[model samples]
Target: MRFKDKVALVTGGKNGMGKAVAMRLLEEGAYVAVGDIDELNIERYLSDFASKKDRFIFVKLDVTNNDSIRKCVGNVIDSFGKIDILINCAGIMGPVKPTWEITENEWDQLMNIHLKGTFLCCKEVISYMIKQSYGKIVNVSSVSAKEGNPNFSAYSAAKAGIIAFTKSLAKEVATKNINVNCISPALIETRFLMEMSEEQKAVLLNKIPMGRVGKTEEVAALIAFLVSDEANFITAQCYDISGGRSVY
Candidate 1:
């Protein structure tokens, strides 16, 4: 149980990679609070972890709202007494269209969720982590952040901001025993991929030298390592899990 006694809070934990990470941490023995706005799927998420209900909780969270984030963090602390790890996995695949064709509202919504949301969650929890002198934070960026996908201008920009934010925050908390990092993954097998058109999926898939997309479990394993004691010395780094799609 590498994560025994650790308390982790995973935003967007209702589905996809967030759900996978939550399950991995729970299996490793952590009190996990899942934060997400998708109440409709809570029952299914609960069922997936029926055997581990004692260590799992579902929190209603709207990442774009500061109040919701504050309340969610407070609820986790109240229930677990402390939060040792934070996975900022909440995100949306914003408008996939030409830059000029994207509406202002579309751009703002994407930035608010991917960038501002990460900032808010970190802001709400860092103080508690500082008090304990222990913490691990992992923000989920995308390969688009590094490669600048053709039709994903806003998403690319927001994810790039997440990487920069992760680096800056890592440095800020370097002395407090808190490790901050991010992961940039190319098209993983998530609902997000299903949302794409066939041509879009094919275009992305063809970029991978490994000839396949990444798996949620694979992403979870990387996150588990980054948050565990094994990665205590690692911080401010963006690890790419792109199936050879990105080598830098």
Candidate 2:
């Protein structure tokens, strides 16, 4: 039980990679607090971990709003008493369009959710972690961050921002025993695929040297290791889980 006696908070925990990470953490003995905007899938979430019900709690979260973020963190600390790890997985695939054709509203919405949301969550939790002098944070970035994917400029920029932010924060808190890192994943097989067109999917799949998209569980395993004590020496690094698409 790598996470025995630890508590973790996962945003976007209702589905996809977030759910996968939550399940993996629970298996290793952590009290998990899940935050997501999708309430419709709560029953499915509960069912998926009925056996570990005592170790999980679901909280409503709208990452774009400050008040909502504060409330969500408060609820987590109230329920679990402490949060030792944080997985910033809340995000959306904004409408696809060329940079020149993308609307101002579209750009703002994407940045607000991905970049600003990550900043807010980290800002809120860093204090608690600082007080304890120990914690691990993993931000879910995308391969698009490094590639600057065409027609998805805003998403790319936002994720790239996450990488830079993670590095900066990691340095500031390294001495406090707070390790901050991020993962840049390529297209993984998940419900997120529903947001992409077939052509878009094909274009991405063609770039993976592995000849297939990655799996959520595979990415979750990497995340599990990053947040566990096994990775205590790691900080400020962006690990590529891009199926050989990234070499640097």
Candidate 3:
């Protein structure tokens, strides 16, 4: 029970890695608030994990909307009194195309959700954290952010921004006992990877020297550690979980 009595908020936790993280936290004795635009997916967790229903709540959220984020945070605080951990996981892979081929709207959409959404969530929660003088934030970044891909310019840029934001924010709040860090994964075999084209998939796989895709559980485990008191001495770092593909 690593997170006994603590409350955690996770965005985009319908399926894939987000759900895995949620379940891990719950098993470790944390109350989790699940937020997603897909009401059905978010609610599915309640019914599917009925045994742990007491540890979970669902909120309909569009992270890009400030009002929506504010209310979502409010709802979490109302339910659990305080938020001990914030996981910025709600993001989408932008249009798969070259930089020039990507539309301005697509670029804006990626930035809005991944970058701006992180900002909004943190802005609303930071006050609560500051008051408590304790907090943990883990933003999900991508290896694509570190090593540029062919057709994911918008997505890569947004994720890269998350890394930078995590470091900067962590530094600002270190003296206050709040830690911020990010995990950059390569290919975690989530639904997003299934959505890739054959050519794109091959290109990505070839980049990985390990010759295999990563698992959601692996990322979840790392995330669990990052939020634990054991990681209190760690902050402002982007750990690469890309199966040795990110060797610089």
Candidate 4:
């Protein structure tokens, strides 16, 4: 129970790596509030954890909107009394095309979710964390950030921005006992990956020295450690879990 008595807010907690991180935190004894827009998945999550309803909540969230973010954070504070850990896992794979071919709307939407969303959430939650003099934050980045993926200009740029954002926030709150970090994972086995074509999948697979994509549980474990007291000394770092795809 590394997170016993703690309260965690996980964005995008209804699916993929976000959902896995939420489950991991809950299993470790934290009161968790998941902020997501997926009502279907929210319903499923509630049913799955009906017995632990007291410790869990699902708030409809649209990270791109400041008003929505404020409401979601407010709901979490109302229910949990405080926010201790925040996982900014909300994101989307933007247009997979050449920079010249990507539309302006596509670019803006991608930036809104991946980069601006992380910034907004951190901005709203950091004050609460500073007030308590303690917090842990993990932003989910992508391997594409470090080693830019072809035909993924917007995603690469936005994810790279997340890394810089995490570092800046970590330093700002360093003396406040808050640790802010990020993770860059390569293609993981998720619905996102399933949506890719077989040719695309094989191409991505060949990039991993481990010969397999990462698992959500594996990413969850890394995040669990980062947010726990065990990682008190760690901050402003980006941990890469890319099946050996990225080594620096």
Candidate 5:
């Protein structure tokens, strides 16, 4: 049990990578607070972890809302007493429109969820971590941040901002023993890519050198390492989990 008694906060934990990581933590002995916008899947995901009644729970959360974050996280603290790891995995991909076709509202929507949501969640959790003098934070970034995608400007920009934020903010709190890092994955086997249109999917797949998409479990394994005692010295860096996608 690498994370025994540790409390983990996973955003967007109802499905995909977030859900995968949430389950992984629970399996590895951490009490997890699973939060997501999709109310329908909340019960389903929670059911899977029902056996671990003492270690798992669910909270309906809209990451973009600051108040929702405060309340949800506060609930976790009330139940678990402290937080050890936070994985900001709530994100969305806008339409495959050209940059010129991207609207201001689209950009703001992306920023609010991916970038701003991460900021708000972290702001609320970091204080508890500082008091405990220990914490691990992993923000889910993407390979698109490494190379700008043609129709993914909003998502790319927001993810890129996450990397920068992770580094500087990690440094700011490193002395307090709270390490913040980002995982920039290429293409992972998640719902986002699972339902992509042929054209949209083909364009993205052709760019990957691995000839296949990565699995959420693989990313979860890396996350398991980071959140464990082994990664104490690791911080202030974005660990790339891409399958040789960005050779640069």
Candidate 6:
């Protein structure tokens, strides 16, 4: 129970890696506030953890909107007393199209959710973390950010922005006992993969030296460690969970 008595706020906690992270935290005795845009799905997902009811709460969140993020954070603080950890896991894979074929709206959507959303969440939570004099934050980036995947220009660019954001924020708060870091994953096996074509999938699979896509649970385990007290010395770092695909 590394996180016993701690409070964690997780965006996009309804499904995928976000959901996995939330579950891991709860099992380790943390109070988790799950924020997502899908209320029904969040409710349904929570039902699976009937025994863990007291460990978690659900909030409807739209990460791109400052008002929504503020309200969600407020609700979490009101319920849990303080936010000790933050997992910025809310994201969407925008339409898969060639750079020139992608529309302005699609590009905006990607940036709004992946880049601006992460910034907004971090901005709102850092104040409370700084006040407490201790906190841990994990932003989810992508291998595409470092490797620059073809046909996913918007996602790659936005994820790259996250790495830069995390590094700058980590340095700014290093003396305050706040650890800021990010994970760069490649082609994880999640519902998110449903949107990809066989060709797109092949392109990504070919790059993994381990010869397999990563599992959400494996990434969640990494996150669990990063946010725990065990990682106090780790900050301003971007850990790669890309099945040996990361050159760095």
The segments of candidate 1 whose C-alpha lies over 4 angstroms from its true place after superposition are none
| Model 3 C-alpha lDDT per residue in residues 122-211, reported as the tens digit of each score | 888888999999999999999999988878889999999999999999999999999999999999879998789888888999988899
Q: How accurate locally, in lDDT, is each candidate?
A: 0.96, 0.94, 0.91, 0.93, 0.88, 0.94
lDDT of 4 by residue, 1-248 (tens): 99999999999988889989988988999999999878974566688768778899999999999999999999999998999999999988878879999999999999999999999999999999999999999999999999988889999999999999999989989999999999999999888886777887898889999999899999999999999999999999999999999996
The digit string of per-residue lDDT tens for model 1 on 64-121 reads 9999998999899899899999999999998999999999999999999999999999
In candidate 5, which residue ranges exceed 4 Å CA deviation? none
Tell how far residue 31 is off in model 2, in angstroms: 0.5
RMSD of each: 0.6, 0.8, 1.1, 0.9, 1.2, 0.9
Model 2 gets an lDDT of 0.94
* Worst 10-residue lDDT window, candidate 2: 41-50
Better of 3 and 5 by TM-score: 3
Worst 10 residues of 1 by lDDT: 40-49
Instruction: Indicate which candidate wins on TM-score.
Output: 1
Residue clash pairs of candidate 6: none
Better model by TM-score, 1 or 6? 1
- In the range 1-248, model 5's lDDT, one tens digit per residue, is 88888999999888889988998998988999988888874556567887997888788899899899988998998988888999999988766678889889998999999999999999999989998899999999888988988788888999999999889889999899888998999888888885578888788888777888889999999888888889989998888887888764
Candidate 2 deviant stretches above 4 angstroms: none
* lDDT of candidate 6 at residue 148, scale 0 to 100: 89
- In model 4, the worst 10-residue window by lDDT is 40-49
Off by over 4 Å in 3: 41-43
Question: Candidate 1, clashing residue pairs?
Answer: none
Weakest 10 consecutive residues, lDDT, candidate 3? 40-49
Q: Residue 221 CA error for candidate 5 (Å)? A: 0.6
Per residue, candidate 2 scores C-alpha lDDT tens digits across 34-71 of 99988995787689889998999999999999999999
